[model samples]
Target chain A: MSLCLPYPTLMLVTDRHRSSMSLRDAVRAAVSAGVDLVQLREPDLDDAEIERIARDLIGTIGPRRLVLNGRPGLAARLGLGVHLRDGQRNADVAARGDDRLLGRSIHEAGAVVPDDPPDYVQAGNVFATRTHPDRPGRGLDWLARVVENSPVPVLAIGGIDASNVAGVLRSGCHGIGVIDAILAAADPTVATVTLRQALDRAVRDQQVADTGNHTGILGRGTMI
Target chain B: MTASPWAEDPACLRAALALYLVADPEQSVSGDLVADVAAALAGGVTCVQLRAKRLTDLDAYRLAIELAGLCRQYRVPLLVNDRLDVALAVGADGIHAGVTDLPIEVIQRLGNGRLLIGWSPESDGQISAAAADGAHYLGLGPIFGTATKVDAGEAIGLDGFADRVCHTTLPTVGIGGITSRTAASVVAAGADGVAVVGAILRSSDPRQAAWDLRAVVDAARGVRAG
Candidate 1:
């Protein structure tokens, strides 16, 4: 019930990069494709416009997550959650009183862990990402350390995609936060579907390794 | 793979900030408002409190049920402000009480630990008392003066927050006229979390405003020693 899974690899596919589809349309498309979560990061729009789009997307999202990047008020009004961007600062903590999922970015493994932590810590750019250039990639080892030591659930961020999601999971990350993988794609739905499948498989594999459930898979079902 | 939810989850409540969804039955809360909640949920908000000061209990109860459904879908907890019957009727996460409202022990007994009982503490003495009474969390505030609460107390700057929080064992959140601009200082003052009203609900982009505040808290938490 708690999305705070031990090995959750989230794909932080933002609505910023897609030019053809609006955020609402893109969110719908992403939901159809089964992205584990979607964060709305478009800051140019006004609140009313954002609210209109948020309402549109929330209708389709159901139980799936929709994170508002950098807008706690809108989130608060709607009673949704938010994701704090890296290196941003504010004094508003009232928004944290909500029982919605709360998360933030970490430039490094150290930045990811807080003495008073959030729901999850996002450590990023395991690979090169187009969204951010100021940050150098932290690579897989840093991610592993984050996964191992994080006080909260740790998610690998920056430069993550379907092709490398499996590897990142294998490296001990619980989740993946993506950008170009879904946003830049011609078909975000397909990309999301594939990414989710890959992460699921990796989690299953990790679970199998931990529990040795190979026999159960072999006994009850064909090797998927 | 089967890690305990609490174990892997952050030690502090994920959404320590209180997200107030002001309700109105005379004029229905917009779909955009509901979706905003969903979007906020997506953004990782941890709690929602329906402040239906205008609606009748029955109407509020119905709305609470509907909102609770939305919160449930997102796995976020929903609370009702000073409406125990409505909360119980709709099975909300809990109730947030003001000083004049029900006493802490009554709420605790009523909640039976299933609900999180938050008490509004105006001073360090109140915070200490709330802690002693096993209040789930303290809403310490009027961190700044605002129009939100009429006759709101004097603004307790970050320094004052630190002074008050230093005395309480329970998780404390700085509230009252809180905005993204002041979030970092509150967190830096040793508050466990922050709460707001207009910063998001009144913003042009509530999501972004929420994110801005969240970013501040994240930064504030960074100041602590390892």
Candidate 2:
């Protein structure tokens, strides 16, 4: 399947409880530092609070790049994307048509991106993320394997930060999604900028290795 | 309201933009902004802007809910002024941002085109720039001097207001001090409608005031069309 979004991208998986700053500030700062996508994952708050946070976030970064976690109906209503929890095949949300993106979380090695409705899958505990501390990192090798056979681009998550993000990007995953890298940092802008630079560097280096030209890597450059 | 058969008509924008209300809680005669807005709606306000500076966030959200509900029943659109959070939370139709509010270009990029965004630009440059800035409508004015909003810019008057209106094709609404007396002149100045505050709320009879203002604006639109 074709990747519809920008690759070698950075996504912020926002956790309000873990953020050192307000989630809104963190998301805004991260977007300013080139975080291409935001996944609003705060499930504890009520729907009203979630929607307020979503709008505030949208005002900063806009709605096209934001995805609501496990809130398909709300996401659909806002004309934004939705991220499904593990093993949810909610056809109703997926079939709502072409204007929105549908994302999924997967843990198994045998899993495949569903083709009926094009989707990108976020796979991890790639490196022992704080959000899921108990699960050991599945490692970059597993990530490479996932990218190797996966039908759609994969966003690696879990404990992956600027320090370890390059290795994750080298695994051929489309991008990385992190929580503490931006949210819990002393300054989210710096944190996001660091991660963004590292991710861009890694992708640049890989392009050099691939064919000595950035344009040589097929499907790696297109946004749509 | 409905985007159906009228969506094909160019006047659809004018119809929605005409007879607009800039509903402010601080200026409400009865201290009940929701009821004030409902009265204006009954008097044929085509659109409403919930502009609150003194109320708590919850109060504003509650009022937005009531006003949005009223606008829904009346088949007019309700927009929240400068409070994107309140607007989004209450599921209002749009946001009316000022020159200093959240940048409209960012809203256009990230908003996924969900809310009907309205912006006020006081000059020719801003009005021209607004064409590319994802503004669905332009709140252009101080068409006549207004005391309700003390900080409003100097009155653009009829001639200056008309000169700026020609710069953009977006549905235009003249704001800042429009009243039954001056509302028709705003429409005659090329604005699709008129936006007012004290004209509706501070009046002895807000519904009647709105009815008079709506009629005046409609007649001017007819004149301009003819």
Candidate 3:
């Protein structure tokens, strides 16, 4: 399937409980400040509730930017896309033949199969997040291995914030999927701008690093 | 707000590709390759590449590990020349391949487009093919001819280099015989930057040499901007 996945260098996954504002408002604000993709991840909501939220986000996010977590039919109905958990059924969804973006979440390396590949894979928790405190963060090495083995681009999710984003870029993931870094911030819009700026700087830094540019010494005056 | 330029996106394959330092152990004054690299970085060499033509596989692997550490400490990318295995072993940022090395397509597939691939293309046809093959950047020339790489093909000359640079959107670094005196002209001829081996390595103070070359490159880019 030739799916044109959204350019998700920085994605915001919604958790209304973690925010002071409504999901729609937070998403709208974040989108304005450079959050390129948003995944509606309210697992407690029913199909009707999801559809309602999806429609609202569709208005705000437009085409290909909103991904409905675990509800392919709802996504297809709204002309939106679906993000599947590993072991989730997609063949039935695939047969529906509505051209929408498809993504999957995988935690381990070599989990992506060539025969049934999603357009992009969301892999993480790259670092330990408060939401999943019991689960240890899979360090950058694991992330890099997963990126190398996967056929599709991988977006790192979980525990990624401004401080650690550069290391994540160096790990070779296509981009990052964030949670508290935006939702938990004092000002979600400002937080998103900060994260986006960090992401942009990290990207430029990675590019500079990849080009063999000296990294540790350039702007910090630590040369020598 | 207007849409962001494709070039501004970090995930896009564009690199600064400026002030490339082709690290040669034999040419280092201190007889210490890593030390020389540190000195060069201090002087503003933007990139560091380890080109160990005479080291054994184990030795190269050992040295790459050390050099990669130093590069990581400085946040510079460590690229291993012509040794994909060493690059993979050290977890280097990329590899610089000569024509005789593995093809760019093979490297891309093996690297899964994760590792940046730099190719040295001699002709316009080769440069075009390299870009189409998705090479991250092209290292073009023997721009003025030099003794660094005995087999560095014929010098492309300034005018010829300019003609070649116009052929591709991929960033190009003019290599071979680039010195502070000639570095400006190379940048003027439309190179994203100049890659030097002897100019920095053979200098009494590699840092000073790199600083001088960087001044020339920055000035040339300023001229291009104006």
Candidate 4:
């Protein structure tokens, strides 16, 4: 089976209003920063608006990977991937005939894997945060369980930062899903580069571990 | 072959489930694997996803064709995962794609209505968006936790699950770590169906396990309806 891994970077699209950073910019930033996938999450946008943004973003992403949150029909219309916050709605949408990449946001171990296994799960609120303050955060321990139990790749979101990105990956997550870290940054590109660097370093470290060399640190050696 | 097992009819989904029987050619999945699926089918599995992960594309294609034939005999639909080429070559009923693979729209365009498409949802927003997008149906879960999906999301509790369901009108099946004991709870939380792998695949008697799980789903749904 093709390996199911998390998007290398996730850019939660929202307007910050300095210069216009539309969905297109979000896509551009993600791509420029080496994001493997980009999801358009304008929950308040109308179908036409979503359609417009999706259309524009698609051109920018150019087959990198674009997910339209909660609008499978539109996603299908645009031939984009669909990410569902709720699995049931996604199932119903699929039943109606939009067969695509259906993903959901899972906050716990038993959140539900759709009958049709999804491409991956975005598990989050890994740390306490300003995003979705109403919900409690799921710590790294809980995140680890999610990583261990899911049938698909789990992308950890909610309060993820460059500092903790390595821990999230080490906890068995396919990758980290960033929100404010990217969207809320002064320079999304810089933030993204830093996070990507950390993630890349983790991968390299993992490789070393896999190669049976665990007695040394990433850059430190015992001098053979 | 036969009509798609995921018929438009909600009753059709509940009447007979599609049972997936996975066997890796490199490693035998155990004869009991078939027995579990058979029992589940007997108990009302209307369809099956024969995912032979270890086989080559050609071999998987042949195996899918064989399994499709068996499903036809049993009047169940068979779906292939991530193998659009094999699915098309085998003429199976549908295809299921993960986020990393082909999008549903591509699947729909390629299938030309002959194949039903299903997606995986990990969050409520994803589910809501997917419902609006017109997916064939969704696989909601890793309900109790499972090792099968190493990167799954946090476990949304039953309350959280119910909350997510409030957003859509689609028929859904719960997946991930589902078992007889937890199946009823998932159904009670408003899942239209329950999909299991190890619960039946790794069982001592897959068939019997399938039946038992089905019974729980049916019973729980009935209670909710009543």
By TM-score, who's the top model here? 3
lDDT per residue, candidate 4, A130-183, as tens digits? 445323234455567777888787787766777767666776777777667777
Give residue A153's lDDT in candidate 3 (0 to 100).
82
Winner of 3 and 4 under TM-score:
3
User: What digit string (tens of lDDT, one per residue) describes model 2 on residues B150-169?
Assistant: 78878888998888988999
lDDT (tens digit, per residue) of candidate 4 on B1-226: 4445453444444333322333333323465344444454544454577666667888787777767765553445577877889988878877766677787777777777556666776667877887555566677666667756556677666776677777667666677777788888887887776766777667666556655765466467652110
Give stretches of model 3 more than 4 Å off. Answer: A1-224, B1-15, B223-226
Q: Sorted on TM-score, highest at the top, how do the candidates line up?
A: 3, 1, 2, 4
Docking class of predicted structure 1: incorrect
TM-score of chain A of each: 0.83, 0.91, 0.90, 0.82
Misplaced by over 4 Å in model 1 are: A1-224, B1-10, B14-32, B223-226
For candidate 1, lDDT tens digit of each residue in B193-226? 6776666666666556655665566566652111
In terms of lDDT, the poorest run of 10 residues in model 2 chain A is: A128-137
Which stretches of model 4 miss by more than 4 angstroms? A1-224, B1-10, B17-36, B223-226
Clashing pairs in 3: A212-B47, A213-B46, A215-B75, A215-B76, A216-B74, A216-B75
Docking band of candidate 2: incorrect
| Per-candidate fnat, comma-separated | 0.00, 0.00, 0.00, 0.00
- In angstroms, the error of model 2 at B101 is 0.7
Candidate 3 shows a clash count of: 6
